[model samples]
Target: MSALPRPARTAGRIFAWTVAGLLLLAVVIAVWVGVRGALAYQHLQRIQTGAAQSTAALAADPSSAAPTLARLAADASEAHQLTSDPVWALASHTPWIGPQLAAFGTVAAASDELLRESLLPLATAAQNVSIDGLRPVGGRLDTSVLAGLVTPAQDAATRAADAAVAVQDIDRTPLIGVVGTAVDRADDLFSSVSTAVDTLSRTSRLLPDMLGRNGPRTYLVLVQNNAEWRSLGGIAGAAVVLRADDGRLSLIGALSSGDLPRGFTNPVVALPDEVTKIYDTKPARYFQNLTQIPDFTVDAPIAREMYRLKTGTDVDGVLAIDPVVLSYLLQTTGPVALPSGDALSADNAIPLLLNEVYLRYAKPADQDAFFAGAAGAVFQALADGRGSASGLISALTRAGEEHRLLAWSAHADEQAIIDGTVVAGQLPVTDAHTARFGVFLNDGTGSKMSYYIDPDVSLAWGSCRPGGQSAPRQLTLQLTLTSRAPADAATTLPEYITGGGVYGTAPGAAEVVGNIYLPQGFELVSATATNGAGFAGGVHEGRRVLTFGIDLTPGASTGVTVTVRANTAAGDAQAVVTPTADAARAPVVVATCGAG
Candidate 1:
């Protein structure tokens, strides 16, 4: 057959034309989307560059970043408009690459929202308030400056929070390649912005009152000594009453633990049954032991009650800071002169206040006086606004991050606002997205030997199984305690440093009670101590608690590794460890199951 029938030929021609037309249309649509996406990507890159520059500029001069903020908003709006085109939106529903398109558009929209609603408004609000304005003047802060920023900060925080939620709601599982990476990066950026702004907002709302805008406010400042570790850092070695009236701050009174009652016949506050069972009534009875429970809400009340009993004054709030915090502040203050004729700087503040004070002074009274002098000098520097305001802020920020700066407001309303903040000094709280573990340390040796401790905490998430109420993920927390004490520390170290053979610990040895608090929903698989060491286990506040008594002689090291199965699915893992004399190290995270 040389030729086909006419009908068959006509049908074949029709089919060929239809296929050609469809192919051409597909090509046109692809080209259109590609061009738009390329332009959007260019705008996004510009935004990123502009944002980085704006951040630096804002830090240097908050008012001058308005131009950059405006440009960023413009770029973000253009990118959002391009990605939101009807054709681009329609193509985003397709398979495979559809998720990529959707993610790109989501990022653009979120960026636009943040720039316009949060950043721009914040820039405007910050125009009148510079870092210099925050510096103290005659031991007083101009609360009005921050008062003006409250409304704008609140608005920006709300917008930022909403934007963060929108960005985080994007499901990254289906994304791949560069799109996945971009989405993840965007998620992180938005989340950080939200958190930072939220803190600012809360601070703006709370600080004015806390500084005594409404009335006179008096807060008890607990200067903890990290040399003898407690659950919340260390014992309250010293205390000061800080008075604030209409934004003016002054140290009204100061005392050391030696000045307070040694122990109470009864607890100033009722101890929870679990707390009593696990930690006994020491946390409530002794002023130094108030922080032994690792909860400032409880620790603060007892501290206030003790102060009231010692002197008939009730504080409005309690703020705690350790030697590490003092060290951080010293970085900004340059150096403060102590009563001992030595200058305390950031480099030597930790050592001098924590270690040398004990060794140099044989009597507790002398040590207390030395500590009080150091505290007063540092406080005077801060009150005089002796350093760069930004540097001071940075120091405080670092201290807060290290859990060395803690606050507890007696007011219910203010306490509610501080509940989830880093400064609240509460135990680690876990959620569906983040599982938190706590490594609280308490010294059983009753000595300042904790200054020689070197702590290394590591957390890892193993494989995950998909079942149950949620995915069950395996996790491990490894804590290593190394003693840096000299070989002849028993004789070389002061009697106070070695506990004088008290607390049942051998001289020149450190007995640390390591309390490992597991995640609330996690089940303990095993808690293994290196070298077959013994441990005590219990349940506290709906979480499994493992207590390891680590006795490290001179140059000795001990470790505890705890493995558990987390029933709740979480993408992030956090370990809150007690602040030590040594610089805080970040928790080591090895996540095989995608838990950070």
Candidate 2:
């Protein structure tokens, strides 16, 4: 309003211009970061595809994959540098978007570390000892080749596992939208790679010594029949004693459940009151029931004693496998000829071994003989190196993932490495990151009726308290069991398959004992059975157990829904159920938790 204020107005105008210039600079920086980030994301998609292809080729041609792995490592390294550039680092200190920026940098760094330090080194080592090098030749595995991979595998596994932990430790709650999702995806990828490498490392360490590098080792191989459910897949009806000496393997003898005495006068090993209360001495007394308890650590010892009492041969370890695994192996070994003139191929192994044998042979003795012969033939083919090495490895990996292959060792150090793995056949483990449940089934029909039972498992978690709060969260597990047997099974099916009511179960009805083991520290709030089925509760290995007995006649169905509360909230909820004759049942997880 006055001429004397002219100097003050000019000063104000200069200050306004300075502020506008700074804002423009900020806009330029934001646009640059966005464009770079989009390019990085596109490149990462290509890296992921290349990584999958390279990994697949590693088993076939390790040397050829090295160049691709190195290129991926370079791309990941570039991404890390781009995300941590000076401008991006400065913007990471901003208030609202700071956490997102930091998370991006963290993920990029982790990817770089995983590819360069873990996978690249692994590719180099794999070239030295390819998957083909581990195959059995002339009925013997060359242990020396496996022994050579132990150190390199351990190194690669340790690096990858450590990287995975770092990625998993990133707190995604503070990040917004796609940043949080990106963190989760990275965590999943690292966890899977770490698990696979760790398994390889463990195998490299265990196989040499367990294959009799030091001395002779004997193992009792239980060929579980999933048609007759036991807690650990099925009953051990057919078995063989395998001897390993200086990397050479030979089957000493074959035996059936009938070949051994039934119901030992006394338990082979002292039983815990919990076990005896639920299972009595049945797991130890009857050879067919040895897997009824669901804990292989305990079952293996009893099996060793049973074999000793029956054949006077002391075994160094115990192994259990279902016909599903045999079928997987057959995919590699081609068809094996059975004594009955029926060729056992990958396509027919499951139904033939689990069902057709029962229908073809009315007598129990004939069925056992056929099963034993099938098992022996498969083993002989594998021992003769009759398949692709890479195919064999893939088959075993698939079986182990499904918990269809199990092992137990008498040696303490080796057993320690095997304990927490899928091969251990232990109860599902729960921790801060995962809430795991076990839904195991054992047949009470005293017949091979489980092959006709189909299972459906669904898991869902309730809304959880935000952040690091220690409030309990709810998880619901719904298991549906459907009987697929024909309506006139009692009259049309073989008496041997139906049990003929010998064990007190109705002729055509299937009786199943379902044992649901809750996660450690989780409480079972409620268990409701459908169709008037009855359930009981117990405790095993410090976990809550819910037992349901469901009796289903031909063309009938039933189910049990359980609600449990976790001590701490977890985003990952999983269930491991009994492996049946059907294709593996993947648990369905929903966001809402309820009986519905």
Candidate 3:
């Protein structure tokens, strides 16, 4: 192999370069194919698991069983090709309700290869949509493109249908905008609220009464869990009667904290009979609901209540959102301006806090002398050494967005409030109560009640404030309802028990029951209970009887009427009537004589 001609040598150099180029190309192609294959495999795994979980969730849902099952069936039919076949014995092995987009994101974050190839695409898409799709409508920043376009209502519904968790706190409000941004800036917020609500609504399974309304009203009952209500015993309870008569939301009797709040109060360690007694005291108020837990995964109590309303009577919608967290967030974060130039960023503290709740942010703390002795764990979990409020803010933002309930949060202040009308509110039991003395005025130690008038009409002003009774230190863990108004109300109902306001007055049975009032002035009513029937068996025989023998004060014409509902249903042609103050003249013992 001596030196060849010049033409041959040039050709040899070209051939060498070609060979090297081909090798490099081969390596690049192989790497790309491997990365793509891995991602496709991971995605497929997630889909399979997600589908199974969706199917199982449908079966778990009592109210939406049919629809959920139907949807699952349809998905199964479609994804049959994507699923494990006889050839792929591991198809059904996809974890039930496999990882969601967030979970996928998390997993992608862990795998560098997956991140670069898979999540990078999603990030790109999200970025483009965030930049180009988002626009301002009428001087407001509108996330409409992300909201309605990248995330369609139908798709939202579908994702919810595929979720493993149930939606509990659907917002009573629409999406809110404030501070020139949306409170809930993340797309995930929608996923949370809508999904939770859909699940709860489907799971609740309420039946419509003649009025087509589920419950009478959202009764804000305050119960204490102090030593008095517990060791002393569950006594009187209070309530703020919101009579949903034709949707007008009539405000009726407002009892003081001394009365019904004791019934709703829960002990730090023990739950008692007060729960039942609260219900029993006002049986006529059938359509009842408890406010949602301030900041936690939706609990068994809420689920029980929803189940009762959905399957039994048309219970009124619950307005339970953590008032303390809201009060704190509203005051601390200040007003959240919306994308629509709405100044909700500051003013609508109440609704803004509530909407955030629907989306599930960590519980907040008040900047002022608020949240004195409350649990700060939830927020701490959110703040988690972010080491700064900004970090806390970032954590909250991410949490809310991930939950898709953030739309209810005052996240960006420029996004339109998801749905924006605040017709009613559930005062998150105001605060978690410990058992208190059944007596209202007396801490059992005897603290007299104080009053701070509204000045204009002498309405409720600082009633829940002052008085040595302001913060009773006896929470029994057992809860009951009470009012901050109606000075004459009981802190805990007489003869009530634990777990509910149930009491034993009957001749044969050993168990007790509880009841709540149906809404007044409403053409229709509905109701439900948690734990057990009739508010943990607070009813005696079958009646949820509220005996308010209105005494006529001097020149007094209007008296508060207490409605009593019998747990037993009347036969055909026989309508059960709840008595008002006008019915006082009638005999209390009107006998229909059980079915003979």
TM-score against truth, every candidate: 0.93, 0.93, 0.24
Model 3: lowest-lDDT 10 consecutive positions: 450-459
What tens digits encode model 3's per-residue C-alpha lDDT throughout 309-364? 33342234322222322333334344443333334422443333223222232322
Model 1: residues with Cα > 4 Å off, grouped in runs = 1-22, 49-60, 464-470, 587-596
Q: lDDT per residue, candidate 1, 1-596, as tens digits?
A: 63999999999999999999989977887898899999999988887667756754654467898888988989999999999988898889989878789889998999898888788888887887876677789999777777677898899889988888787767655666777667666766777677777777888789889999999999999999989989888999887788889888888888999998789999888988888877899988998898999788889989999999999988999999987788889888899887689999999988889988887899998888888788888888888878877787778877876778889998999999988888888878777656788899999999998888888888777754311125668888888899999999999999899998878999899998888898888888888888588778677778778877888998988889988886664756778888877775642232322211
lDDT of 2 at 163: 81
Ranking by lDDT: 2, 1, 3
Deviation (Å) of 591 in candidate 2: 8.4
Task: Write down the TM-score for model 3.
Answer: 0.24
TM-score of 2: 0.93
